[model samples]
Target: MSFRNFTTGQSHGFGGTYLKLVPGEMLVYSDVFDDPNLPGEMTVTVRLTAVSVGTEMTVVQENVPDVIPVEACYLGWQDSLRKLAGLVEPEITG
Candidate 1:
């Protein structure tokens, strides 16, 4: 997917292919950045498990480029997951 940062007016995108998928259980994918500066193929794995209250999800990313700090990548994932939760979780109304 492609994304443009409105604030910085900087744009970059990455393309990924699914390496493995197990329906609702797990998914593995590889991502390659469009920018040459970020030179590396990133492998992302996602796992889903059923719980009494709800589903639990885990994400793991490997082979991240040296240019990006680990903490920054983690923070980015946190923000993205928060946005995802907002979309998937239901609101309780009176």
Candidate 2:
């Protein structure tokens, strides 16, 4: 997937194939950055579980390159998940 930093006008992308998929239950994929500086293949796993209120999601990433800081990666995941929730969750109006 490709992404751009609106604030900095920097853009980059990664592409990978799905290693495993269990529709609505789990997903496993590998990613390789387009930038040569960030050289490494990263594996990502996502799990979903139904809950009382909604679905719970868990994400785990492995083989992240040493160039990227862990905190930045975490914050990026948080931001992405927040945006995802905004898109998937229903809006309530009083």
lDDT of each: 0.91, 0.93
lDDT of 1: 0.91
Compared with the true structure, what per-residue lDDT tens digits does model 2 show for residues 20-87?
99999999999999999889899999999999998898999999999888997888899998999899
The whole-model C-alpha lDDT of candidate 2 against the native structure comes to: 0.93
**C-alpha lDDT (0 to 100) for residue 51 of candidate 1:** 96
Question: How do the residues 1-94 of candidate 1 rate in per-residue lDDT, one tens digit apiece?
Answer: 8766567897779998999999999999999999999898999999999999988989999999998899978887888899898998899899
RMSD of each: 1.8, 1.5
Worst 10 residues of 2 by lDDT: 67-76
Show where candidate 1 strays beyond 4 Å.
4-9
